[model samples]
Target: MTLFETFAAHVDHALDALVAAGTLPAGLDRSNVTVEPPRDAAHGDLSTNAAMVLAKAAGTNPRALAEALSAELAKIDNVTAVEIAGPGFLNLRLHATAWLDELRAIGQSGDDYGRSASGAGKVVNIEYVSANPTGPMHMGHCRGAVVGDALASLLEFSGYKVIREYYINDAGGQVDTLARSAHLRYREALGESIEIPEGLYPGDYLIPVGQRLAEHYGDRYVAAPESEWLVLFRKAAVADMMEMIKADLALLGIHHDLFSSEAELHEAGKAEAAEAELRARGLIYDGELEKPKGKEIEDWEPVTLPLFRSTQFGDDQDRPIKKSNGSWTYFGADLAYHYQKSQNVDAMVDIWGADHAGTVKRIKAAVNALTGGKVQFDIKLVQMVRLLRGGEPIKMSKRSGSFVTLADMIEEVGKDVVRFTMLTRKSDAQMDFDFAKVVEASKDNPVFYVQYAHARIQSTLRKAEGEGLGLDATQLSLLGDAEIALIREAANFPRIVESAGKASEPHRIAFYLSDLAAAFHAYWNLGNDQPDKRFILAHNPALTGARLFLAANIGQVIRNGLRLMGVEAANSM
Candidate 1:
C-alpha cells in the first residue's frame, strides 16, 4: 500500500476503535472522509478530514473529536506528530523513515511503482479521431487524437480493460462525393481533361486513387456511367482513404483495436433493428422536427418524419431518425453504433470536435433510452487548436489539401512535441500551439523542462557508475529536509495517477509532471551553491550513495509519468 493508503487505513482503524470504546456512534458513515497531501507543505506531510466529517454524527464538536483521534493516531509507528488545525483538520507529520520506506518501494517497483488497480478491470471503450474516411486527418483532429490516446493509456495503467475504437463514417453522402471525385481522377488518368468542379474534392490526394483505378481496370470505369461504377469506386475510394488515414494515425503512434464501419451497420440492418427496438419501447415515433436552427423557416417543409423522443430524457427537442424518403439519418446509424458498443463494454466515451456541441444532448438521451440507463456514457468535446508559428497564425498545409493536416504538424515539430503540446491544455479550452515555444529548450517549455530533468538524472547516474559508486539505502535516514521535500513530490505520483484516471483527464498528468520537474530542478540548483547538497559528494560515499538512490527513483517516476502521457523520457539532452 502507498503511504496515503496506509494512513487512511489507520484512520479507519481509529474510527472503528472509537466505536468499540463507545466514544462514537456505531455504523457512522466515513465515506466522506479523505486523506490527502496538505496544500501547504509547511503544514504537514498529510492531512485528514475524518474529524471534520464525522464530528456531527459522533455527537461531539470537531475539535474534541480531533483531539481524541489524534491521541490514538499518535501511537501508530512513523506518525511522529498529529496536530489539530483549522476546523478540526488532523495534520500529520511522519518521520523521515516513512518517506525512506516509500523511496525504497519506488526502487523495488521501478516502472510499476505508480500502477494502480483503481479501475478494477472494468471494460471501457473509447472512440476517438472518428474523422470521415474521405481524406487525411487535419489539425482539427489532432487534439482529440492525442487526448483520447493518452486517456486510454492512463486508464490501462490504472487497471482498466480499454478497447480503443474508431468509427468510420462511410455511409454518408461524403463518400459518394469522394467516388465522383475519384472517377474524375480516373477520367483524367485516362487522358481526358477534367475540371474538379466546385463542390467536389479538388485536392491532388485523389490523383493516386484515380491512377490506381486506371492501372487496375484500364478504360472500363473511365467511360462508364455513374450508376455502373459508383458503388465500385466508392468502395475502392473508402478503402484507399482508410489506408491513408491509418498511416496518418500511425505517424502519431495511434492505433485503434476496432474500426467500426457505418456502411456495415446499414448493411447488417443494425440501424433498422435499433429503430425497431426503440419503437417497440415507444421511444420512436413519426413526427415533424423544428426547422434547422439559425436558418430561414420559410423554405422548411412541415412534413412528418421518423423521430426519437429525445426530449423526454433532457434534450431540447425530439430528434429525427429517418428522412421523409425513408433513409436513415446520421443519428440513426449513431444509435446503432452506440448500442452495439454498449453491448461490449461497461462504459463508453466518445471524443468529438466542439462543432458537434449541439448533438451532445440528443445523443446522450438516445444512449440513455437504448441502454435503459445501464451503461455509463460520456462525450468529451475538444475545442479547436489554433496552430501558430513565431507568434503568427498558420493557415494552410499542402498535405492536408485544405487546412493543416495532423501529418503536416507531426512532420514539422515531431510526434512528442505535438502530443505533449496538445495535452498541455484542457480539452474544452482553445489553445494557441506556438511552434517556436513548444520546441524551445527552456524552462518556459514544459515538455523540454520535464524531459531535461529526466535527462539530468540519467547523466548523474552514468557519472556515478563511472566513479565506481554503489547506491546504498542504509544511509537513507541521513537525508535532510530538502531531500525529503523532493521525495514528497515524488511520492505524489501514484495519487496523481489514480486521480487523473478517475477523472478521465490526461492533462493532469502533464501538469503534475511540470510541477515534479520543477521540484527536481529546484533541488538540483541548490547543489551548485552548497557542496553538501550535491548528489555526488566524493568525500562522503554513504551520503552520495543515498542521494543517488533517491535520484534514481525520481528518474524512474519521471519515466513512468512520461509513459502515461505517451511522451518519451529522454536520457540525454
Candidate 2:
C-alpha cells in the first residue's frame, strides 16, 4: 500500500474505534472521503476529508467529529502530528522516517513501482486514428493517435486488458474515387500519358499502386468499362493504401490489435441485424426527419426512412439509420460497429477529431441503448494542431495534396519528441506545434527538460563508478530535509498513475513528470553552492551512498513515468 492508502486505512480503523466507543454512530457512508496531498505544502504532508464527509451522517458537527477523530489518528505509528483546520479538514504530518521508507520502497519496486491493479477485471477497447484509407496520415491525425496510444498504455499499466482497434472506412464513395484514380495511374503505367482530373487522388503516392496493377495484368482492364474493373481496382487500391497507412503509423510506434472493416460488416449483415434488434426493442421505426435548420435547401423533400429514437436518450432529434434508397447511413454503420465492439469488451473509448464533435451525443445514445446501459463508453475529441516554424504558420492544404505528412514530421524532430509534445496539452485544447520551440534545449521544452533530469542522474552514477564509489548499505536517517522533500515528490507517482487511469487522461502523466523534474533540478542546483549538499563527499562515504540511493530511485520513477507516455528516458542528453 502507498503512504496515502496506508493512512486511509488508519482513518477507517479510527472511525471504527469511534463507533465502538459510542462517540459516533455506525454505518456512515465514507465513499466520498479522499486522502491526498494538501494544496499548499506549508499546510501539511497529507490531508483528508473524512470528518467533513461523515459529520452529517454521524449526527454531529464537523469540528466536534474532527476533534474526536484526530485523537484516534494521533496513535498511528508514523503519524507525528494531526491538526484540524478550516471546518474540520484533517492535515497530517508524518515523521521523516516515513518518507525514507517510501524511498526504500521505490528502490525495491523499480519499474513496477507505480503500477496498480485498479482495473484488474476490466477489458477496454480503444479505437483511434480511424482516418480514411485514402492517403498518407497527415498532421491532423497526429494528436489523437498519440493520445489514444498513450491512454492505452496507461490503462494497461493500471492492470486493464486493452484491445487497440482501428476501423477502416472502405464502404464509402471515397474508395470508388480512389479506384478511378488508380485506373488513371494504371493507364499511364501502360505506355499511355494521362492527366489526373479534379476530384480524384492526385498524390504521387498512388503511382506505385497503378504500376503494380499494370505489371500484374498487362492491358486486360486498361480499355474495359468502369463496371468491369471498379470492384477489383477498389479492392487492390484499398489494400495498398492500408499498407501505406500502417507504415506511417509505425513511424510513431503505433500498432492496433484489430482492423475492423465497414465493407465486411455490411457483407456480414451486421447493420441489418442491428436495425432488426432495435426495431424489436421499439427503438427504431420508419419516419420522416424534421427539416434541417438554417438556410433552406432548394431540393429539400420529406422522405420516409428507418430512424433510431436517439431523442429518447438525450439527442436533439431522432436520427435516420437508413436512407430512402435503403442503404445504411454513416451513423447506422457506426452504431453496428459499436454494437460489435460492445459484445466483447466491458468498456469502449473512441478517439476522434474535434470536427466530429456533433456526432458524439448520438453515438453515445446508440451504445447506451444497444448495451442496455451495461457498457461504459467515452469519446475523446482532440483539437487540431497548427504547425509552425519560429512562430510563423506553415501552410498546408489537404485538397492540394501538399499537407505535412506524419512521416515527414517524425523524420524532422524524431518520434520521441513528437509523442511527448503531443501529450503536453489537453486533448480538447488548441495547440501550436512549433518546430523551433519543441526541439529547443531549454526548460520551456518539457520533453527535453524531463529527459535531461534522468540523464543528469545517470551521469552522476557513472561519475561515482569511475571514482571507485558505488551505492552501498547506509543509514537512510542521515538524509536531510531537502532529500526527504524530493522523496515526497517522487512518492506521488503511484497516486498520479491511479488518478490518470481513472480519468482516462494520459496528459496528467506528462504534467506530473514536468513538476517532478523541476523539483529534482532545484535540488541539484543546491549542491553547487554548498559542499555539504553534494552527493559525493569523499570524506563521508556513508552519506554519499545514501544520497546516491535517493538519486537512483528518483531516476527510476522518471523512467517509469516516461514509459507510460511511450517515451524514452534519455541516459545522455
Candidate 3:
C-alpha cells in the first residue's frame, strides 16, 4: 500500500511490457530503477530513472532510451503524459483518479497501509538505555530510549521480529560502591548523623534506600565489616535503583522485553565461557598494551594482561581484556557478555549514549571475531540532550538532585507530548528540549500539530454523519487536490517505515508525522477559507461523503503513526 512502492511496481510492469514488445532488452536488471517524486512538483507527479539506469547496460543513449520508454509508458491507463526531461529522466504525470485511487488505498489499509516486509521477518535485538543503574536516567538517555524503541517499532512494522533489551551493569565497581553507600544509609537510619565521605554517592535518592536497609536489617550491619555487608547491601541497592529505573522508563511508556544483567552473566559463567571460546579460537592472548594515550590512571601500566586481538578484525589496536591488577576489565566482561548474547539472536544492536562513542569499534570488532563474523553488531550512539525552556537552559540533573526526573516531566506534560518531543530530532544530533514550548498546543509544537490534525478529522467526520452521508472507504475515494495531497502523504507512510528501519533512525517517523499533519491542516484551513473545499456539504450528500472519506483516511494514518511512536492521537484537541 506504499505509494512509492506501488508506483515502482507499476513502472516495472510497464517496462516489462516494453521488453515483451521488443522495445527493451529482455532480462534487464531492473533493481537499480527507482520511482520518486520530482524535485519540482510542477515538473511531474513522479519521475523514474529506468531509462537512465538502463542506458549503459542496453547499449543505447539515455535520451534515446527515455524517448522509447516514454512512448511505451504513454499508453498506460493512469499515465496522463510521459515526457523525456533533460539527461534521460522520465517524468510521468498521472490522471487525477490515480491520486484518488491512492486515497482509496489509504482508506482501505488504515494505519497498516505503510507496513512493509523489508526485513523479511528476521530477528533483530536492540539493546538501549544501559544507564549503569547508578542514578535516574538523564537528558542523554532520552534520545537513545526513544530512538531504540521507535526503531524497534519501525523494524517490527517493516517485518522484523524485534527484541528490545537493556543491559544492567550490576557486576561493576559502581555497584560495590553503591553497597558501601547503602551501608552508610543503613547506619544513618540507625540514628547516627553520618557524613557521606569522599568517593561516595551524595544524591538525596539514597536516603530512602538507607532507610529501607535500616528497616530490613535493624542496625545489624552497623558494626559489621564492609566484607560482611557489601554483598547484601549491593543487592538491595541495585534492586532499589533498578526499581526507580523501571518507574522512570514507565513514565515514557517504555518497557524492555529483556534486562540482561552483567552480574547474572558472570554468575551463570557466561563471561568465563565466552572468554574461553575466544581463547580456543586463538583470538585471546597475553600482551603488554601500548601505554594508553592522554591521561593514564596510575594503576594501569604496560603489564602482561589477557588481551583480545581486536586489531585482527579492524580495531585500532589490540585491547587488554584483563587489567594489570589481574582483574577482568569492563571491556572483557562486555566481550563475553556480547558473545553469550549473540548465541541467542541472529543479530545484535547496542544503543549507548554519546560518551560511549569511542567504544563502538572495539565492541563491534569483538563481536565480529567472537561470532566468527557470522553476526553483525551495530552500536547506535545517541547524543546528549540540552534542556531549554523559553530560550534559557535548564541546568538540572537527577544524579546531583538538581533537576526534574522523567516522572516529573511526564506529570508536567503528558506522555504523548514527551514521546513525540523526544523523537522530534535525530538520535545522533543534539536536541533542544524546551519545556515551555513542548506543552503549547500550536503549529510550533509538533505533538499538538499532529494531534490537532486528528482532532479536526474527528470533528469533520461528526459533521458528515449529521448530514446523513456514509463516510466509509468506498464513499471516501473521491478526492480533490487537497484530499489527494493528504492521501499521497499517507500512501508514502510504509516507505518511510522501511527507510527508517534500514537507516536505524526513528526520528524520521516524527518528521514524517509532522509532514502528514501539515498536509491535513492545510486541507482543514482550506475549508475555513473556501467553503467549497470543506469536507462536509450540507446540501450535497455525494460530495460530502467523498470529503468525509478523506478526513477518515488521514485520521487513520495519524492514529497509526502515533501508536508506533507510543504517542496518542486524541480525538479531541
- The number of the candidate with the highest TM-score is 2
lDDT of 2 by residue, 272-366 (tens): 88888889889999999999899999999999999899888778889999888888899999999998889989999999999989889988988
The best-first sequence of candidates by lDDT reads 2, 1, 3
The residue pairs that clash in candidate 1, if any, are none
TM-score of each: 0.96, 0.98, 0.93
Worst 10 residues of 3 by lDDT: 472-481
**Residue-wise lDDT of candidate 3 within 1-573, one digit each (tens)?**
455776787788888887887878898898889888787878888899998999898888999888878887787778898888999999988887787778777777766777878788788899988787866765657778877887888888988888999999998898998888888888888899988877877777888999999898897889988888899999899889999998899888889999988888888888778788889989899888787789968887457878888888667888888776766788988887888778867777888887878777888877887888888778888887888879898887543557667777788888888889888987778788888999887898898999988898898777667767767555544556666666677766776777778888888888998999998788778878898887767787777878777778778888888888988788886
Model 1 Cα lDDT, one tens digit per residue, 59-168: 89999999989998999999999999998999999999999999999999999988988889999999999998878888878899999999999999999999999999
For each candidate in turn, give its C-alpha RMSD to the true structure in angstroms: 1.8, 1.3, 2.4
Query: Which structure is stronger by TM-score: 1 or 3?
Result: 1
Residue 222 in candidate 1 has what lDDT?
A: 71
lDDT of 1 at 68: 89
After superposing candidate 2, which stretches have Cα over 4 Å from the reference? none
Segments in model 1 whose C-alpha atoms lie over 4 Å from true places? 57-60, 291-296, 397-400
lDDT of each: 0.90, 0.92, 0.82
